[model samples]
Target: MEWEAPALVLSATPYGEGSAIVHVLTGEYGLYHGLARGGSSRRGRPVWQTGNLVRARWSARLSEQLGGMTAETVHASGARLLDHPLPLAMLASLCALADGSLPEREPHPAIFQGLTSLLARISLDPQWAVDAAMPEIVRWELLLLSELGFGLDLGQCALGGGQDDLAWVSPRTGRAVSDARAGEWRARLLPLPAFVLHPEQTGTPGDWYDGLCLSGHFLRRDAFGQRHRPLPEARIRLADRIARLADVVPPDEATGENSPQPD
Candidate 1:
């Protein structure tokens, strides 16, 4: 069987003397692994870097077998961000999360689009690191949770019907809780930033941190926790960087009252 698709290189590792095993996320194929002959060679190395967008063709005698892939560069997203540390980190973290959390060969078109949009945003503006990158990254993390079936319901209170004053998310159920409903139990719920609940809001950095914390909670509890694996180190590091940048209390140290406030 043979097929071609637009793909994002997630990871590549040496296989034989000059060959590599490449993992990629595709718009149609989801996450896939294939053998890339000469992928370790100087000529092919640039195309295999994580976060590069490529046009890839995979061919195998049997549809279920790991196939051989031949790719041509479409957009060298990673190369463009090489000089920018924070955006580079964000890209690496995004690739790592998708590579780690997603099931192989299961199509997730939304995730593919989200990733493409994120890369496009960063690529268009060299100064995205200062302005829009972090918030977009946080938002993408939320979308990842949703695509994986661990989405939070932030429209109304999980306990009461009120939409106003919705401030926290129940760690156990991944649902939003109103400030009134969480009066006593607020100490235990994760902060649901207004921006996450309402994307139209231009959130502050603190709100971005809270949004990450809210999404990270379920990412840990529902995604990695169930697999008996830890959240990717890249993700943890990105969260820490965001915490510092936002100057907000880290999720581990945040309580209801101290959660980052919305702009």
Candidate 2:
């Protein structure tokens, strides 16, 4: 059995002399692990990077076997992100989360398209790649949660049934709460990022920081925690890095106001 598709290289672990255990995400095939011959060599290394978009072909004697993968670089986006710290972190966390969380061999077309869109935007931006990808990564996590059956109900307030002025997300229920309804509980609820409420605008670095905190909570609790795993270290580092960049509280920090938000 064999298939060819546009794939996002999620990971490449050097396995033997010149081969790698490669994992890629595709719209049609979902996440697939394949053995890539010569993947670690100079000529091939650039093509298997974590965030590169590639045209990949995989074949095996049976549908269930680990296949041989050969890919041609369609966009060498991962290498370009290396020069920018935040974009690089975003790229790395994205690869790590998708690779670690998504179920193997189950088609998630929307997730694949969202990833392709973000990769295209950041890679094509010669100057503003960080700006281009910032909002998308946070939003992508929400999509990931939704696709995985943990979607946040941010359309209306869980407390008031109101559609406007949504202020906080109930970390307990993954639903939105308006400020008026939140009242005394405001301090406990997660901040519902303005950019998430309004996708037409670009968020300040600070708003983007809130966005990460909001999504990271449910991702850790529902996505990773349910599987008896913690959120990926790459994701933890991404939050910490973005916190410092935006000058905000890191999501997982222990503080006096509340207990440390544990996964």
TM-score of each: 0.91, 0.93
Q: What are the lDDT figures for the candidates, one per model?
A: 0.81, 0.84
In model 2, which runs have C-alpha deviations exceeding 4 angstroms? 253-263
Give a tens-digit lDDT track for model 2, residues 69-114: 9999999988876777777777788888899889999999999999
State in Å the error of residue 60, model 1. 0.7
Backbone Cα, N, C clashes tallied per candidate: 0, 0
Q: Please write out the lDDT profile of model 1 over residues 65-181, one tens digit for every residue.
A: 999999999989888888887787788888988988889999999999999888767765758655667667778888888888888777788887888998888877777888888
- Taking all chains together, the TM-score of candidate 2 against the true structure is 0.93
Among residues 3 or more apart in sequence or in different chains, the pairs in candidate 1 whose N, CA or C atoms overlap within 3 Å are: none
Looking at model 2, the pairs that clash are none
**How does residue 83 of candidate 1 score in lDDT?**
86
Error of 2 at 21 (Å): 0.4
Candidate 1: regions farther than 4 A off: 253-263
